[model samples]
Target chain A: MSERSPQRISRSALPYPYRADGLVFDVQAVLLDGEERVDVNVSRANRRWAFPTDDWERCRIVGTVELPSSVVDAVYPESERDSPPGSLYVTIRCRETIYRDRWMVQSETVEPKTYEVELELQRDGFRGEVELKPYLTRGAADQSTDDGSYASSTHARLASARPWTMLVDGEADADGETGLDVRVESFSTSPRLPKDGLYYLDMGDPSDPLIVVNGEHNRVVGVLQSEGSVGAEARMRDVVFDQIQYGVWSQLILHAGVAVDSTGRPQYDWQSTVLRIFARDLYGIDDIHAASRRLKRDLKDPTTVPEVMQRIDRVLQRYLRQREQLINLMEEGLRI
Target chain B: MSSGDVDTDDGRLADNTGTPLRTLTSEGRRLVDPAFLRGERTYADEVGQYVDEHTSDVHVELQGLRADLQAVVDSYDQYDSTIDAAAAPAVHRRLDISRRIAADPGVWHYLAVVEFPEFVRYRWEFNTETAMREKFLGAGTDIYSNALHRLWWIAELTHDGDDYSLTEEVLQKQTLANKIFDRWFARYRPAAVACCAKLVDESTEVAEEVTLRLNRVFSTRQLEGMDEAELGRLIQDLVTDIQNQGTTD
Candidate 1:
């Protein structure tokens, strides 16, 4: 299994030169693994720096760069003089590198290294550029003293590798006897971060489908484990969540091993899934764990169906009764 | 382009209130402010002070653009007498501005620099009125308002990466174009919007068919009864059928 390299550094340490007349300005460039590069600029005029198109033209680099394409991307030009502003920023993946000597060096004895370059310019002209030296220090490795319970990296890897899936348990014919008698036990919400551990389910049978329920905020609300290779899944965590303070929960259904229809769309019969009951602001870890355990136990127990359904209905009714309040909560969250 | 007799501060042109119009010029571009443009003060501010100090040939050129726009409206009316009369005036207003901006890049640059809230406000007002009166149909929708918004919405509703031609196709169909604006305020998901657009394109029966189906689907027990995954799949299926029909037939 391949693990993504962890590269975290501050803005100051990154390389780049900066110069300004009367306004403050800064620029940073990073060359990643000798395969990808990124350049960022921030200036007082626009307070945002963008990759200069003339630079690429002057550098005469070949292969496609990671700038937004004018054809597919629509932009309101700030001024006619600034044509094809390249991008407000750019991350160029290496089809090739111009500097052979400046390649990323790695060794068995050393942790991975990252190099950054920065430059700042004023209205007049070039200000300064800085080159960030690679940080060679490594953090402590996992030890036995750490918590015994660890997250499943297999699930994480799979989630990242196969981010989209179709739901099978939800697809079971509602009118047919084959439908699984699934019931909601308990429901709780948790804040999903930029990086969240993944949990995998093998439906035990290849014929059965996996069901995922996503919420409105794109959170994974529930997962229905069915029997099979119905390979539908979603990224357990989303990249967008990195910058957002408030998280959304989604009800998703994943069906495994589905093929695209003639129209380049997925073809799958998703099963019935419902968000019967929900609890809010249960921010404590213990509270969430307890709720999950309760739900799992109730789902396993056939006798809890009527009670679960009643509780779900009650919660939903309460929510509907407080629709205005819910809206206010959402608005408040947005303000935050 | 040159106003030799024009007073620097107080331009002679005055509104019905008898106050001289403020005038500003920068890089040979002239701006006359009956009302101040929003945002930070620039050369326009200096010109307003200049107008306050002097009162000659204040708004001769400013009035010229206004007259040019009115003339364009009159010409459009002459060209299409039977066109929606209520919409014609507003459409002409926008067309006049667009034409001027297209022809004289300096005016366009000045417009950009001034950052007048009134300009945007009036443009939006005209756009909304035209859209409402015309049943939300017209190529003018993209040309008259924020070009960025028009381009984005067109790209979004059209089939993936196929909007280059479909944009024109969508704009040409008055009924379909109207439907786009009608549903602009609807609370449907992003996927739902695409589905609706696809449905409109796939069928010749107009947007009513798809809209009616969507309404019925939402109102039925299916919407509340089905799980999220189920709803997504069903919607995807409908959209797929529509898209398939669009490409094939």
Candidate 2:
């Protein structure tokens, strides 16, 4: 069997030539749709961010990256600049494995001090993360023919910014399966925690948020795995578990804050542990760094209370109207 | 040029999200079903459901390639290897989409599993369940599988701008393409052209040996920095060596 040799990808691992000197190539994805810019609170700390496929539909990713002189030299030696052997270009590349799409969104053939990146990715057909890379392609004179050699050998990525990955999935409704899956499995079959545990995160692939429903918990599994049959018990069980799930939001907020970039985009780096953990308050909270800072409290100080936990309590109170549901249950009992 | 049905069972689709060029994502249901792979049926409406999603809307139009492929499948009564080679240029001609979109597996996945599955079944004949799945959904980045995708890509790699002479030669005659797919170096268009030019007339057995010899040569010498003439000379040297050695062997 022939090994898969994708012509698009360079075969060799490109080591940064100036790693010792700490020369960095950075590409920041500044969403360009809102008046000044988009204020979507996404975690980009891990150099990765996820948007509901539609959230990015109209948004253009704009960022600037400087091309160090040394890197330019790698593409063109001093002696050859007067009459260059090949045309050099800088381009923004978006790569998605799930759908297997890799193509240059933007390209600039003229060598400049910096390369500006811009493009809006289509939300259609693609359901996974798309890696954005800015690399230099030198179409050398020798291989510059009508033949497809340039597509194969023209790219010699001299030096570019660390790649930025754009994650596209709206894991909104747990029942709705698109970007991720919520599986029901028998955890009781294992030698672990309480045999009745309802749900646990299988963090094996941090890139994906897979919520494993413990099949041992009949009530939890039955409710979660059901299509449209929700009884009073299922509704009440959903309300109770909604608290556990809602309480998870505050932590995601904090993590999003700690891992954000200078532009305030959260750099969760691989810690998007629970993607479905969102709430009414989660949306429209533009400045996560500021919000997280206000909600933060030094745990080392014995006198200080983790203010985030308190905030979470308020969030939990409004979760599926827990207080309202509890009161209704109590009143029904008294009437009975 | 016609639009695909946009009404979706899932909310994944939107008003103005992407191009008409579709892809069958690995998410949710698969286009190829189990029974279909087992060759138990010719077609299955329950084969699969694809979400109505797309790359961003762009002004990309295709040249009725699917209809062309369907015609090819119609010509063949049963499994014949020549069908792919025969249909390749038609795929290459009509769907000369942006190399970027072409690189995407989803578009090909959509075609093979959704649009032209009959063609896929006719081409490979679902020899085995494992092989059938690969023909439908397997071969990540490998150009050897996915019946329709393999054909289109093979044509793309071998075709020049507005010229598919090389592409036709590779697919139609079964001359030099498959044997060269093994070497990573042949992905370079110049090298592929040079190698094909040198080995097209050789018999299958002789061509196979020469290709192996060429693969060894590429191991040391870089195809990236080298030009077409140099590649041609290098391949010519190997062919000459083979011709000279014919007397002894």
Candidate 3:
């Protein structure tokens, strides 16, 4: 047979570079002492993440998690088993070459650590549990070990210190899929603890640093950084901002371990509770204050309670009317 | 054609050539033609007029209602305006009904719909199609639609699939929608809905503080590293906590 040109083969099959699975962690923290604590709970049964590839570089992997009906009932007692909590699944596929060159670097080059955690209600009767584990990356298998590079320094610190773990039992299944079962704890040092409270978890590198923290209340459940070089202070600030306005700050306030006083009274300070709840419920405290100020200003006078109430009603009525008029105009304009 | 000249007595406009140029009224204007000068009246204009006319009436009614509310507030011995505001609507409605039980409170409910003043109207430009679309989708339209959407969205955004007690709290708050809902939703999206519900569940003081801080942070932080999904989750978490705290007592 005449020599024939070989057909060009495709280098990659997937659209995205990596895949990630997020698990819902039902984390409970119990403060054993001032400096030590224990956390325990079930991890998010379902995982969700995205992978990258060509054309549409990001691909999503999604799958349903079938927890034992009993577990479902325990976690969501009022929820019917017929309809389990639906989990979002995402996967990203990318070219093998892109995966080799880029995804590898993004996943690896960070250290792992463990932490001790605890929780106590300022009062009695409201108590909770805390759990700690190491957060690890599975995709990093082979890479040059150069400590001079920032990534390398952060990685080295992480590998050597093996600090506190933020993620627990994150691994891939037989099908080359990553699975994580983490207890969604109510507390994280990064978000709740003050900046000074963050110890090692806030050190080294400008992009990816090796920072670790041992909770003073729950020393065992420390938070560790496995990726990014930015200092823990700046990063913690960002995390704090994110958590308070748009992240887990709200969740913690709503579901935090509660306690009661010896006199059968709730021990949580009302003001603190209010602050926590506001941080959790409102995106930021500033917005609420602005609204309150606006409301107060609109009220004009506050001589008596009845007058104040009438003013409030008037304000609400006015507000609703303004909105209605706007909507009506929009509808009319659309028709035109 | 000649008969047209005689038809002039029949009240029709005719040209010098004796043929009708076009129909005209005694006022020398087109009788049947469309007038391009007719101006459009907006809801804002209507509402502004309504407010001006009823200002005194509203003030009087408010005065009476305030007296009744003061009595309730005295009984509770609570002085916070936020708390008093929450109790105002139900209290006002009750007092109004007590005056006229023979007539159901349903008719009075429509009074809540008011006109938009001109100054406020100028604050927003309704010139674009996108803006128009958003206006319709927002909770400011018809009472039934707005109320229904507000209630349902609050429930959807705030509820953790099962817990809706906070949603109830949100519905109870007068400022929840006006002072907090729109701005939060406009700036934050679906997350704001949940946040508003949480704010209601949480102590109003806390909610107020958080909203204030959030606004400040949003203005200062560039937030380049964070993605929208992450932000949504964060907001949801905050709202969830608020709900949890609301039930703690």
Candidate 4:
């Protein structure tokens, strides 16, 4: 097959000129290779805030697609291009630590694939996915009478829902169905831990959809939702383990940002471990910030997971000296 | 029509609160606190000018807009109907304001908690405290719940480019509008247009069924990849099935 259309590369770290705030990430791209290139500018129009709340930032993709060289040659053949020949189509994939969400502009038919395109995608800390795809119009050419005006682009969206199989690990509600199984109880909890059943371990928030199944020897095997905050997921892992009470080992799955493993488990990596460490301190403390108010007020509760993560990290910090090894272990197994 | 030159003393302005309200708030903490509204600071005549200048093309004053909104609230004792009518004008007026002003919760905080406290009081008489403190401050997508923000968003999602006839269609049925407002899929313009057309032609019961079925289809499939015509055809089939089911019922 023709070079499988260059699978879009996922950057471990955000490309340069991109910034990630608490819940927002911002990116920008300009024309890279086209006779007449379209300017792709992506940015969040709203302000950024923390997670668990509906503090979603509505980002936008805006740019112009000029008439392509082939089309210009075919139409005017020998005149200075005055008006935009067509509009740009944009698609953005916002990868988060808990889940990978995608937002794509309804694609437009673009003719000859010879145009160069560039874009900068920005989101808040909540959404880390940022890559822009732009192409010239293969669809009907612009009917604008004006010689050189630009066309309007579409809005950016945070993926509201994805294929459930894409996020959770379980037998499909159907024989082989996927997407959000809003009603599946495959991952759930009970008072008496069943010796041989799958259950969603009890995180502080029972409503969280992350799946935890009963593993061998009183342990629970579960994958964290890769789309959630690294800090939040780590905290959930810690809390779920503690709530299940002692003697039950917590085999937590980690992730590198939002990328997961083949079985839909969160991939463990050094970045996620470090992020979890930060979350433990910031959230583990007693009311340092307004966002941490609930953690402080409810610290005394049995379900209220406190910060023992840092203590554990310090111990591991001695042996797992290099971040690369820790990162690899996060993806592979680090049978300690 | 610069926002810095509105006439606060205009007879039409409502001075419901005896104390003056602050026009601009730069600090985050003070922005969320209700105490900021009760400070020594007073709203300058110029501060009031911002709304006038922003909404000049709309030609409606805050006092008039508030009264018109209150009238809708009064007539349609049903919450949904009242919201549909009341929110449309708010969205129309907001379209006239700068996005910079509308995007900031601080500006809206000043409008709901400070400048228009009486209107806020009128709208949510039973829970004014919660309404002013928590609801007024835009929090997440829930910020759309704010009195001003809610209307603007409802309009944003329902409107087709500059044509808001679709908004009017959605306003007639609470089920259709609520689904459109809350769900991201419904914000897809083609989908919204298709849903509104179906809802407008059907009964409330049929509309509900169509919306539910449509949502189920949307959540699973990638509606983003479908073009306008493709979305229209898909929604039309769903509407037809619901209609056939309704007839059998």
Best by lDDT: 2
- Cα-based TM-score, every candidate: 0.22, 0.48, 0.19, 0.43
Cα lDDT of model 1 by residue, B141-225, tens digit: 1222332223233433343442234444554454565454444222122433444445445444535555555544543111212
Of the native A-B interface contacts, what share survives in model 4?
Answer: 0.00
Task: List the candidate 2 regions with Cα displacement exceeding 4 Å.
Answer: A1-180, A185-336, B1-19, B25-28, B42-49, B58-63, B74-77, B173-175, B209-219
How many residue pairs of model 3 clash at the backbone?
102
Looking at model 1, give its docking quality level.
incorrect
Where model 1 places Cα greater than 4 Å from the true spot, the runs are A1-336, B1-168, B173-175, B178-249
- Write down the lDDT of every candidate, Cα atoms only: 0.28, 0.51, 0.28, 0.38
Model 4 chain B lowest lDDT segment of ten: B15-24
lDDT of 2 by residue, B101-163 (tens): 565666666666665666777778656765777676643345666676677667766777878
Model 2 CA lDDT for position B22: 62
As for model 4, its CA RMSD to the true structure in angstroms is 18.0
Q: Candidate 2's residue-wise lDDT over A70-149, tens digit each?
A: 54454454554444333222222222222322334234343446655555655443444565554444444344332432
Model 4 has a DockQ score of 0.02
Q: What are the DockQ scores of the candidates, in order?
A: 0.01, 0.04, 0.01, 0.02
Alpha carbon lDDT at B36, candidate 3: 10
Question: How many collisions between residues are there in candidate 1?
Answer: 67
